[model samples]
Target: MTTFTFHGGAGEIGGNMLLIDSPGSRFFLDFGMSFKRHGEYFSEFLQPRTSNALGDFLNLDLIPDIEGLYRNDFLSHNKMKTSEEPAFDGILISHAHLDHLGYVNLLHEKAHVYASSVTKGIAEALDELGSGSKDDFVKTTKSFSYYENKKGEISRIRNCRDPEIKYSQREYPLTVDRGEFEVGSASVQIFPVDHSIIGASGFIAHAGGRSIGYTGDFRNHGSRPELTRAFVENMASSDLDILFIEGTNIDEEKGMSETDVGNEISRLITEAEGRHVFASFPVRDTFRLLSFYTAARNAGRKLAVNFRQAFLLDKLDSNKALERGKDIIPSHDEGLSVYIKKREYGLIGEDVEEEEKARDYDKKERPYVGIDNQICWKDVRDNPGEYVLFLDNYSVQELVDIQPVEGSIYIKSQCEPFDAEMELDWGRIENWLDRFGLQVKRAHASGHMSGGEIAEVIKTIEPKLVVPMHTQRPVLFSDLCDCEVLIPEKGKSYEF
Candidate 1:
């Protein structure tokens, strides 16, 4: 018997947790957070209680409440049942996007992770560069443990104080080859697919004599459409029993290609003439970053990025998986430079004392602080036309220091605001743009397949059953797919 359960991403866009049970195997596809559900209860100031172990998350129904599937330390701390072994064989992460692999930290250590080498590198960078909580993909932090103090009193262990007791390094086996690998009784193969992120992939699993294919957020309009084309060709010949496809942009008719985006940005930069150009884009989307990079270089301007982006770029460049795909800007490129922000007490510049400026940066940021290609706000303010500044909402305050001139341009190379909170943030961004008298332009390419594109893929694959995951319009797929389209309910199991 073969079974499939939709733990998350049933009728939603993200939080893609799919449980697959076969003759002798049980595993999950992804374990991510639902942005829609999470936003309903928490905000920046209000968050899940770390001291409560997994109680706050399980009680609030944020994570699935399944026995023997989580870490022993958290379960024991909360007085819940602890299992010596993990219930599932392992988890196969398709990419490093938060919508796909955010909550992997809560799973048991034995449920090892399998992903491409580039995905692993990006996950490590996100954890190291982000806040200490919630982004621990490379290592799961040990929490809610207790120890005996010197005076013989029981005291809770602090991870910061005890360096050795802080984290448990999770096992990650790289999926580098095309051969089938075993996760308990199931045979699995992961193939690289083109998406917005660097190392996105899809899965093919054979369990209980059934062959299944899962498309984990793919696209055909990016810089490298050949990857997706090869994935479709592989599925066309697999004779798949079932196909789990993503329909994130199933409602949209079409989207621009990466070349189109680059062309538009090049035109914009050329017209910016003696004024500065500021662009906002997703930091991890290397294709989009390359578009901006190419545009700036063609227009005789240098591209400036924040320290965090520089760190992630370095990691991506070092990964060998990216070598065969779209090229990442070289670290030694003269057109690329790191933009330093004034932090802590806001002391910066060559005139400031070295000790005073050093206090502004954390230890991780010190390596790239005074490098050869580092640029400060004054450098950008003085030579407006010589640089294209990559600035996001969190760093918008730096605009006040740079004071961009009246005729400058601001290119938004990302998606539009989707929810109310993002809409509010866009309003604030407009206020800053208005104060500077800058013109705003929009140019971006989506990272998912459109409605017609997915329909073509369904027609090409010709699977017996097409189950929709990571989409809100599962019923819409019925009109597009010739095969049986199963609309799965959240937490319900279906057997074949």
Candidate 2:
């Protein structure tokens, strides 16, 4: 028997988790947090207490109620029953986006996690650059052997893999590959798809004689439009029984391309006279970073990024893991500079001792490697027009220090804010620009296929059953495609 369970990513934009149960295999498609559900209960200051983490989320239905899929420690802490073994064998991550891979820390220890090689490298880099908490992906360990157990006993039992900190790099479960692989009875073929992210992929999963073509999140307008085209063509020939696809931009028709955004940015920077440029984009969109990097170079200006982005770029570049266009990696380059915030006590603070620096990566020099070509806000303020700054929402606060004069430019090189909360954030961003005297400009390309584009893709593949996911209007897919559309609800199971 083959069954599909919608654990998440239903009638929403993010938080994609699903269960694929076949006679041979049981696994999850993603393990992410739903922003819509989370915002209803908690805020920045009103977060759930660590003592009641699982309880808080469970009470709100923010996470699933599966038994053997979650970590034993979390369930035990919440007074919930935990299975002695994991119910699922693994989780196949589509990409490194937070909406797709954020809740990896909640998985059972025995779960074997898989992603593309680039996705794994990006996840490791993000973990090194992200805040250290129990929810983090990479575990920090000083010793390679035994760890201090909860009971403070010297036990040498080794049976689990994750949810808790791995404590050692050797125990990290980041087994990544391309092409066909099996997780128990289920057979899966991973095809790289073009999305806003670098390692986004589509899956062709087969179990119990039923095949599912799942497009996690895809688009056809970026540096690699050909990739998506090929994926669509290939999946069309797969003769899948079910086609599961993301409809993130299904309501829209026309869309912009990455080349278009780069040309616009290049024009804006070249025409500006003595005005500094500020651009906003997703933190991990390496290609977008490179596009802005190219724009800055065209205008004869260096691109200044925050320490975290520099860490990601430096980690990816130093490892030489970026496959397609390794030369586009923007670290330790003349055109790139790390913007070190002049903080008194943060990670990049001048007062942080050499001995007390971060110890996540195997390399001893990782803590301060990317901060070598550091530039303070004052450096930018002194020579405003000499650099183009990348300051998305999180780093926008730094504008108070730089203090740009009137007529400076601000380019929002990302999608327009979608939800009410994001709309509020967009307003706040405008207020900041108003206060700082920066002229606002809009230029961006989406990471999802539009309605017309996806309709064509659906027609090409022409599967027996079509299920819309990663979109608010799944029912509308029936009108968009020629095949039978099934709008799967959250937590519902469908049999094939």
Candidate 3:
């Protein structure tokens, strides 16, 4: 018999933890941390772990211990155990998204971890770019490794229960077979799927004449839509007993396709009076970048991207349009006159030469400026006409420090969480808008499928049982499909 349990990500967005046990072995799908509420987080800083780490435990109902599930002792150094300690057989990382793979480093060294080749590359790249917090839960057993230096202070945190023990580093094969792997008595396959980020995937686990499918996070459109469709069709014919799907856009009333959203953003940029600043999540979606490129080109304004965004574009050398240098602006250009926050420049790299490369442009040409917080005020005073500011969720408030003139707009080019509980800053965004008088517009499309598209996928996959994950409204499946919607509660086991 095989049993499946939902440890986290049951009815929430983050902290996606799932446990699958078959015969003598068990494994985890994902383990992530959830953001806490506003007041709760503030109180948590005053007393770490004592007060629930910003109410994440309370909000997700995670405070109460679930019977039969292992405690998250892997999160702390003091409570860590040796390899001989009880642990899962393996962990399957579906993709490189922080929410999906965040708590992965928590696994013991003896446990195996698996991901696709492309996904592994992206994950390493993220660590190189200083985005290694996703794996903070894991400890480093060796001194010489790509991630050793960065794991310095993190290794010192005290473990909760066991004071004498030290945690081991996470160990896994560089790449795993996408087709299937045996874990105890069950077989698991990794299915590639299209999403905002490259190399995202779903999973198919089969055992005892029953099969289950898990869609990590996916979209049904864009360059890889066909691949996604094919995966769905293949799963449909596999006689699967259950399917776990993601319903990220379940509550969105009127969502546009990626192509349409791109066109709309282009229109907005075309009509803008000044230079355009676009803050985007630079992932696998080249269409969004292309849309910004087209809009800037049509408006006769240079498209300026931060060093991190530029690096993302560089990694995607596969895109012919971006590679040909159509409308994209290289990071280091002198005489380029747009000001960006200085702290953001740190993402490029630590090397002084590499940092200087962004500023090394033709001095004879028009000055294109990148500004840090201290110098941004100067750029605003000197080059107000040449700048249009684009703000992401993280740096939106920086615009206030610049205080652009009336006609300038702030374009939000990503999905804003609808659930207030899930958002990090509540009402802070509205307050910022009110103070700046900057017109705010959502010029973004999701990287996940809509209700209709998810329904189409269900029909195509045709699994014996349908389950939904990574969604707030899992009940929506009741209206879309005829299969059994197995809404497993946290730690509640389902046997096959």
Indicate which candidate wins on TM-score: 1
lDDT of 2 by residue, 292-321 (tens): 898898899988887678777766675443
**TM-scores of the models, in the given order?**
0.95, 0.88, 0.72
TM-score of 1: 0.95
Residue range 1-496, candidate 3, lDDT tens digits: 7777887777666556787777666777766544432234434244334323313443445432332222244223233223454356677787777777754543444556667665655554454454122233333222112221233533433322222233344455634425777765667788777677666777887755567777888887654577688678778877777787888776655466666766777677666666324444444344565566556656655444544454444444443323234323333432122334545343222246633735543332113333332124345534544443444556665664566666656666766656554364536776776677766666776788888888878888777777677777888888888777877576677885
Local error of candidate 2 at residue 437 (angstroms) = 0.8
- Native RMSD of candidate 2 (Å): 4.7
Query: Which stretches of model 3 miss by more than 4 angstroms?
Result: 36-81, 129-134, 137-169, 174-185, 251-254, 275-290, 310-340, 343-390, 397-403, 421-426
Per-residue lDDT over 350-411 for candidate 1, one digit per residue giving the tens place of the 0 to 100 score: 68777668779998888877788988888999999999999898888888889998689999
Runs in model 2 deviating more than 4 A are: 131-133, 138-177, 318-321, 324-330, 345-372
**Winner on TM-score (1 vs 3):** 1
Candidate scoring better on TM-score of 2 and 3: 2
lDDT order, best first, reads 1, 2, 3
Q: lDDT of candidate 3? A: 0.57
Which model, 1 or 2, shows the larger lDDT?
1
Best prediction by lDDT: 1
> Candidate 1: where are CA atoms >4 Å away?
131-133, 146-165, 175-179, 330-332
